[model samples]
Structures are given as structure tokens and as C-alpha cells.
Target: MDYQFKLLRQSRQNLLRFTEQFTLEELNEVPEGFNNNIIWHMGHILVTQQLLCYKNAGVPCRISDEIINQFRKGTKPEALVPEEEVTFIRKRLTQTPSLLEEDFRNGLFGEYNEISTSFGNTISNIEEAVVFNNIHEGMHFGYLLALRRALTKTV
Candidate 1:
């Protein structure tokens, strides 16, 4: 559990780096062949973590439903995300893992409903959900990387 938490923090650190490295325009730019941009990926990662861990555990999510609707699975960027919202999402990108770690330590998640992920794994508990969330985040982080590369190529 300690290592899982540690890996999650480190992985989020990488995501935070991406957030800092891009401007609002760069983050919002959807490169060719990509359906979404860096900002959407960041938002999606935040929403996905809350949904998989808190919502699936029957606990109230720390984030709002509007965020989940905008960035959850199968969604794409419909309009430019403004600077203020980008800042909010960037703050969440750094803060969420720590808050989640604290919540898990406090046993906020006592039970989790089993969910079959699009990646094909069934998560049955908070620990599994945390672990799987990292896998999901990693996949999106990879997308973030590819999106960055594509955006830079087009520049």
C-alpha cells in the first residue's frame, strides 16, 4: 500500500510537470489525429480517479459532477478550456493524490463496488481501485506525452 501510494504520487508529479510545461493554448490544442488535448487528458485523469475510487466506493466524490461530465470516459474537448478552469484543473492535478492518500489513510473508502474497466480489469476494493487508477492514469499520461509530441511537431 505504501509503494502504491508512492507510485501514485510520483506518477502525478509527472502529470503536474506536463501541466507546468504547457501554456493554456498548448494545453488546449488538439493535435492532428488526436481527439483531445493535454488539458482534457489532465481533467480526465482527475475525474477518472475520483470516479474509480470515491464514487465506486459509494463515497461522495471530492469533485463536482460537472467536471466528471466534461472529462470522464468517452468525452472530448468541445470548446477551449479557459485559463481559470485550467488553473483549477492544474491545482487538482497536484492536490488530488495527496487528498486521496489522506482519505485512504482515514479509511474513507471502506468498500468498493466492483467495476469492469475499459482496460478489462475488475477492481474489487479501494486498494485495487487505487492500483488500477494508476494504470489508467499512466495510459493517459502516455497520451499526454504523445499529444505533446504531436503539438510540438505542428508548431
Candidate 2:
């Protein structure tokens, strides 16, 4: 397994477990002034997995175009996705890491295009993007924690 993939899996599992503590209402709550709900964040992470791996690897995504469009890099959270769909999304999240590994092994990786975000600098390879996304996901994990607090009125 690639070290980057391992990190992504670890973070992803942590995110899922963290999410499990919340009720559906809590997961769906946007919290005043926030851009998205917990469900959106979770979906976004999965969407990012494809964008950073399969799409960048020069292979088409195995997930649906509608999902890709909804969760892609810049998509916002205001879009309404049902709670049931969100729950199903969590299950689907389990399947992406292996697909990423497949892309890596099949030499499906393509040259990195520049990603302009808080991370800064142009990435020249998929490995760097993989590493960067770990940090990116962590940042969102922080948001998830905040959302949990906001929705549940708990610390």
C-alpha cells in the first residue's frame, strides 16, 4: 500500500467514526453562517478522493457524474442531499481508497496540475497531491468537529 494512501485511509476512517457519533439531524445541520453540513463535508472528502486520484490519474471516475458534480473540488454545501443518501455515501467512501491504489499500480497516474488552495505551490506529481489532501482532509475534520459541537450543543 502506498504510504499516502494509508494516511488517507486512516484519516477517512477517523472521519467516519467521528461522524457516527452524530444524529442525522446533527449531521444535516448547517449551523448558522457555515457553508455546509457534516454530510456535505463527508461527501466532499469522497469526491476529493476521486478528483485527486482517478481523475488526475487519467482514468474516468467510477462514481457517478452527478456525485462528481455535487462533491467536486469547489462545490458548496448548500445543495440539498437527503440524509439517506448521505448515509449511503459513507458506505461508498469505503470503496475509494482501493480504486486509488488501482490507479497507482496500473501506472494510471498523470502529471499533476496546479491546485490553488491554502496549501500553496504547484504540485508536479500525484504523490504530492495525495500528501496534501491528507492535510486538507484533516482541516475538514476540524470543521466536522465544530459542526458536531454546533449541532448538538455539546463541547
Candidate 3:
């Protein structure tokens, strides 16, 4: 579990670095042929983690319902995310994992409901959800890389 948390932290750090290079416009730009943008991916990562780990466990999620509505699966960016909200998301990208670790250590997730992911995997426990989340985040990280490359080419 410690190793999983470590990987998650490192992955998010890489994401933060990937996002820091883009201006707000670039972060918000949905390049042709792409359904979403870099910041949307980042926000989705945050929202998905909360849903998978806390919400599925029958625990209250840390993020707002509005955030869940905006960034959850099947949702595209409806408007340009302000730099302020981006900043909040960036902070949570790091903070949420630490809080998750603490909550896990304290045994806050004793009742995870089995949930089927869009990727066809069924997560049956909090531990499995956390591990799956790392994979999910990595997938989005790849999307972020591809989006950045596309955005850069158009610049």
C-alpha cells in the first residue's frame, strides 16, 4: 500500500509538472479530434480518485458534487476552467493522496462497494480501487502527453 501511494504521488507530481508548462489557454484547448483538454484530464483524475476511493467505499468524497458533475466520466469540458479552480485542482492533486493515505491508515474505508470501471475492470475493495486508480491516472497521463504534443504542433 505504501508503494502504491508512492507511485500515485509520483504520478500526480508528473501530472502537475506536465500541466505547469501550459498557459491557461493551452490547458483549456480541446485540440481537433480530441474530446477533452489537459486541464479536463487533470480534473477528471481528481474527481475519479475521490469517487473510486471514498464514494465507492460509502464514505463521503472530498470534492464537491459540482466537481463530480463537471469532471466525471462521459463529461467534456463545458467551459474554460479558471486559473483559480485550476490552482485548487493542482493543490488537491497532491493533497488528496496524502489524505487518502491517512484515511486508509486509520481504517476509514472498511466498506467498499464493488464498482465496474469503464475500462471493464471491477474493483471490489478499497485497496483494489487505489491500485486501479493508479492505472487509470497513468492512462490519462498518456492522454495529457498526446494532447500536449498536439497542442504544441498547432502552436
Candidate 4:
């Protein structure tokens, strides 16, 4: 497996563990002023991989636009996601790392337009984006962990 893809797989597992015990109310809470929830963070990571890895390469995203928009960067869940949908989203996210593995093994980047990342750096290649995504995923995972702590009194 490619280094980036492997890291992504590890990240996904960590996220799954973080959310595994949370309730719908916990996943839906906005925490007063915060604009994010556990569910949103989970979906965001998946959508980002799809966009940066697949859509940017001219491939169609396996997930829907509505789901992406609801969980994309800076998007907060305005309504609770159906439990079934959340389950499906998790499964979908689990598939992304392998998709990345295939793309990296082929050594094909296709055409990715340059885009400014949250770090104020521009990434124009698929490899760079993949690396960036891994880092960002970690950051969000940390947030998810923190959210888990905040939502659970026993934590």
C-alpha cells in the first residue's frame, strides 16, 4: 500500500473508534457556539478524500453532493443525520483508502488544479493533496476525540 493510503486507513480506524460509542444526541450537538459535531467531522473527512482524490482527478465521487455539502469543511450539521446514513457514510469512508491505494499504485495523478489549502500553501499534485489530506484528517480526528470527551461525562 502507498504510504499516504496506509496512513489514511489508520486514520479511519481511529475515527471509527472515536465515534463508535457516541449517541445520536452526542453526534448532533453543536456545543453552543461551535459549528461542528461528531457526525459532521466524520462525513467531512470522507467527502474531502472524494473531492481531493477523485473529483479533482476527473472521476465521479461515490457519495452524493448533499452529503458532501452537509459535511464539507466549515459545514455544520443543521439537522441530525439518519442513523442508517451515518452507518453507510462510515462504510463509504472505509473504502476511500483503498481507492487511494489503487490510484497511487498506478502512479497516475491525472489533472488536479492547484488549490490553496488551509495551511496557506498551494497543492497542485495528487500526491501533495493526499499528504495534506492525511494531515488534515489527523487534525479533525483530534477534534473528534475531544468532542467525544466533552459529550460524555464518564470520559
Candidate 5:
């Protein structure tokens, strides 16, 4: 479990570095052929972590309902995100994994509810959720790399 948490932290660190390479405007711009912006991906990453871990386990999410509603599965960016909200998302992006690790160590998610995802996988426990979350985050990171290339018109 410690190794799982360590992987999550390293993944987030890499994501944070990738995000820092772009300007806020670049992060907010939706590439001509794309459905969302880089910032939207950031929000989605943050939202899905909470949904898969805390919300699925019947624990309250540390983030707001507004954030969850805006970036949850099946939602896309509807308008330009304010910088404050983007900052909040980035903040939580780095912070949530450690909090989850702490809570898990304390046995906070004893009754994790199993959920069958839209992608056809079920996460039945905290361990599975964490593993799935790492994969999900990596998918978004790859998409972010694609978004950056599109936005910059670079190979």
C-alpha cells in the first residue's frame, strides 16, 4: 500500500511539472479538434480521484459539490474556468493523495462500495481504487501531452 501511495505521489509530481510548462491561457484554450482544454483535464483528474475513492466509499469528498458537478465523469468544460478555481484544482491535485493515504492508514474507508465504471471495470476496495486512479491519472497525463502538442503545434 505504501508503494501504491508512492506511485501516486510520483505521478502527481510529474503531472505538476508538465502543467507548469504551459501558461494559463494555453491551459485554458481548447485545441481546435479537441473537446476540452488542459485546465479542464486538471479539474477532471482532481474530481475523479475524489469520486473513485471517497465518494464511492460513502465518505464525504474534501472538495465542493460544485467542483464535483463541473468535472465529474461525463461532463466537459462549458465555459472558461476562473484562475482561482484552477489554482484550487492544482492545489488539491498535489494534496489529496497524501490525505487519502493517511485516512486509509487510519481505517477510514472500511465500507468501500463496489462500483462498475463506465469503462467496464469494478473497484471493490480502497486498494483497487488507488490502482485504478493511478491508471486514470496516467491516461489524463497522456492526453495533456497531446493537448500541449496541439496547442503549441509542436511535434
Candidate 6:
């Protein structure tokens, strides 16, 4: 479980670094043939982590309902994410994992409601949910990379 958290943190840091190279417009731009932009992918990963780890455990999520509604599964970029919102997401990307680690150590997640992911994975507990979230985040990281390439190519 510690290893899983470490990977999550590393992946998020890498994502932040990757995204930091882009301007606000580039991050918000939906490349041709893509359904969402880099910033959307970033927000989606954050929201998805909360849903999988906190929501599934019957614990309240840290993010607002508006963020969850906007970035949840199957949702796409509806508008340009402003700089302030992007900053909030970036801060959360670094902060949430530490909070989750502390909560896990304190046995915050005692029971979890099983949920099936779109990828056909079943997460029946917090441990599994955390592991699956790493996979989910990796998928979005790939999408962000592809989106970055496309956007840069068009420049």
C-alpha cells in the first residue's frame, strides 16, 4: 500500500511537470480528434481518485460536487478551465495523496462499497481502489501526453 501511494505521488508529480510546460491556452485546448484537453485530463484524474478512494469507502470526498460533476467518468471538456481552477487542481494533485496516506494509516476507510469501473475492474475495498486509481491515472496521463503532442504539432 505504501508502494502504491508512492507510485501515485510520482505519477502526479510527473504529470504536473509535463503540464507545466504548456501555456494556459495550450492546456485548455482540445486538440482536433480529441474529446478533451490536457487540463481536463488533470482534473478528471483528481476527481476520479476522490470518487474511487473516498466516495467508494462511504467517506466524504474533499472536492466539491461541481468538480465531480464536471470531471467524472464520461464527461468531457465543456469550457476552458481558468488559471485559478487549474492552480487549485495542481495543488490538489500534490496534496491529496499525502492526506489519503495519513487517512489510510489512521484506518479511515473501514468499509468500502464495491464498484465496477468502466475498465471492467471491480474495486471491493480501499486497497484495491487505490491500486486501480493508479492505473486509471496512468491512462489519463497517456491521454494528456497524446493531447500535448497533437496541440504542439498544430502550433
Best candidate per lDDT, number?
3
**Which stretches in model 1 have alpha-carbon errors above 4 Å?**
none
lDDT of 6: 0.92
lDDT of each: 0.90, 0.77, 0.95, 0.81, 0.89, 0.92
lDDT of 2 by residue, 56-133 (tens): 656687788888888776777665677778867888787777767777788778666656655666556778767767
Q: Mind giving the per-residue lDDT tens digits that candidate 4 earns over 57-148?
A: 77677789988887887777788888898888889888878877776677656788788877888878788888988988898888877776
Provide the lowest-lDDT 10-residue window in model 1. 14-23
Instruction: Report residue 18 deviation for candidate 2 (angstroms).
Output: 0.9
Models ranked on TM-score:
3, 6, 1, 5, 4, 2
lDDT of 5 by residue, 1-155 (tens): 89989999999889888899887788889888998888888889889999899999999998999999998878888988877877888899999989999999999897888999776899999889999999999999999989988988842
Model 5 stretches with alpha carbons more than 4 Å out: none
For model 5, the run of ten residues with the poorest summed lDDT: 146-155
Global fold similarity of model 1 (TM-score): 0.96
lDDT of 6 by residue, 1-155 (tens): 98999999999999999889999999898888998888889999999999999999999999999999999988998888999999999999989999999989999999999988889878999999999999999998889878878987999
Global Cα lDDT for candidate 5: 0.89
lDDT of 6 at 142: 86
> TM-score for every candidate vs. truth?
0.96, 0.86, 0.98, 0.90, 0.95, 0.98
Better by lDDT, candidate 5 or 2: 5
**If the candidates were sorted by their lDDT against the true structure, best first, what order would they fall in?**
3, 6, 1, 5, 4, 2
- Each model's backbone clash number: 0, 0, 0, 0, 0, 0
Cα deviation of 141 in candidate 1 (Å)? 1.1
lDDT of 1 by residue, 10-111 (tens): 998888876688888999999889899998998999999999999999999888899999999999999999999988988887888899999999989997
